[model samples]
Target: MFAFASLLALAASAAALQVTQPSNSSGWTTSGPNTVTWSSVSTDNSNFSIVLNNQNTYPQYNEVLEALIQTSEGSVAVNPPSGGWVAGTGYRVNFVKNSQDLSSLLAQSDDFTIEQSSSSTFSAVPLLRPARPRPLVPCQSPQPAPPPLRRLARESASNTDSSAGSSASSASGSSSSTNAAPGLNVQTGVYGLLALLGIALA
Candidate 1:
């Protein structure tokens, strides 16, 4: 019975040392510095350090970010090396207790994967803007269409032309008769008189 009680108490104390940040199996992007959070213990010691590590290789744990001195923050903000974390690679975070004596190692978070989004890489770049088009100027003055010819005007012109043509024909005939030879006209008159005298004699 005493052994069972001791086992339960030991389990509770181990659970108390677990770090809650970067909660079990979480992921982080490498586009910028990551803000990792964990549950803080209210111990007398304020000294604590947090580290991020690449746990992908066998039998070797590579350090990704430098050990960070935690602020009043129960969380630590860390930026990986300039090259950044590897995509699809797994990582681990350890929250270590700092002390002169044998410092108790705090709990470690579960494996978290590092990944990058398509937009994340170019997020810091400026966007290009489209150019403005020039405004078009309209015609200041438009030309007016010419007026149409009326029916009465057409009829009037036709009548004037007919009158002018008839007058011209009559004047031409009269001019030809007047220009005949005087001898030819006198012979015509003498022949008409002789015919009249012969009819009277009969």
Candidate 2:
């Protein structure tokens, strides 16, 4: 019973060494800093080892970044080395407590993306985009093209014709007033000659 109690306490302590941050499906920028977080750790005596794993490994599996850091309560952050993480790469943050056995894995975060672009779906590969508003049609009915100006043009032409006829008639009257008609002069001369011949004969 005493041994069982000891084992249970040991297991409890081991479980207590866990990670709290870097949740599943989390994303990070490749060139920017990233935070790796953990919880329930004893900073007084224990130390920590931070590891960054590549889900897409070179041969079988790979560790891209590793550090034997001192234990703390909060988190660890890293700016990946040049070309450390590429776009579309999957990674994980692991917090391994410095223990004698070193076999136990204290905590490991879920796999996440390392992105090259910040606004690309927040993930390495862009999958979603905001929808665009459709263009709006005018509320007023589409006006039919203005009726052709042919009627107005015809009215203007008719007015021009009437004015032109009036102008021509006025011009004719003015010309007649300026000079007597040649036919009137010839008729008056003939009547005078007839009266003179009649008077001479009498």
Candidate 3:
């Protein structure tokens, strides 16, 4: 009965050694400075190693994150290798007791995700350019203003008088001064006829 009780205590003690951080709710990225944390019942200062595993695969892929580390310090920072981790879920971190021929399990984290880095997933947004102002219509030259009403009437009347004078001058076969008195041509003819009559009588 005492042996059975001792075995139960040992099981309970083993259960106490577990990974605390990077729980099922935790998420990590491939290009990470992420953390893995654990708790242990053993008080010794022995070093341990950390391994990241992809449990989603059939054979399960394993990668040794740290060859030797003191897990009792509660946590350690880790990063994926040069190419970074494969982005997926069902990944776990395991703590193993340092040994020559590997066969000692210490603690293990729950299933979590190792996603593609945030930087890689991000896309650049194009800057919004202010709309170009609508091209201005070219200005047109102003038209010349019309002549005043009084000046227009004056010009029309002057043109009509000049045309009437030209037609009258053409009809009258006599060549006379248009600007002289109207009776001057008839008076000159009468005077010449009278002088001729006086010369015949003499």
Candidate 4:
């Protein structure tokens, strides 16, 4: 009975060890454009360092822009320490371009996926939280409005006619000015004669 009890205790401890094994292996899949989901064999106790495997394809020099952890509970954004991944949880890391001007990245797509190095370790991945819906307000009824046909037609026709007339007038003005070249040539000749006389006197 003592030997049996000792064997049972050893078996229980081994089972516990297996259950508590650290997730050192990592895997990834593209969720959508600009989003990726990373799954680990185990949860992370310390901050995980994820490097972009294909930086050459992305606009940013790095493929690992950020890491996101999603679990049964909720999701969190992981970046630099103040914005890094939460320790002791499974996470989905997303790589994206860093945009300083826009509120969000212009393009979002995982160029390529990366796996955790054999030396790396982590815990279980956390679940993402659902976003709260916005409250709806009662909309006011609209008043009756006049028909827009006349107003729209008048505005459009007037703009078109004015533009056509302006263009025609400009063309005519250009032609008339171009036709007055002989007068300009006479002026040029007079100026040339005066210049020659001045030069002779000098």
- Return the TM-score for candidate 2, rounded to 2 decimals: 0.43
lDDT of 2 at 173: 96
Off by over 4 Å in 3: 2-11, 99-103, 120-202
- Model 4 lDDT per residue over 60-125, tens place: 333354332222222233233333222322333322223222222222223323333343234558
Tens digits of lDDT, candidate 1, 64-174: 343435534666667766666557666777656643221345656778777775546534668788888989988788777655678668888999999999999999988
CA deviation > 4 Å runs, candidate 1:
1-8, 11-17, 64-68, 97-104, 121-202
Better of 1 and 2 by lDDT: 2
Pairwise TM-score winner, candidates 1 and 3: 3
lDDT at 134 for candidate 4? 88
The better candidate by lDDT, 3 or 4, is 3
Model 1 Cα shift for residue 148 (angstroms): 87
TM-score of each: 0.46, 0.43, 0.50, 0.26
Better of 1 and 2 by TM-score: 1
lDDT: which candidate is best?
3
Off by over 4 Å in 4: 1-137, 141-147, 197-202
Error of 3 at 170 (Å): 99
Which consecutive 10 residues in model 3 have the weakest lDDT in total?
A: 173-182
In terms of lDDT, model 4 sits at 0.43
Candidate 4 at 61: error in angstroms? 97
Ranking by lDDT: 3, 2, 1, 4
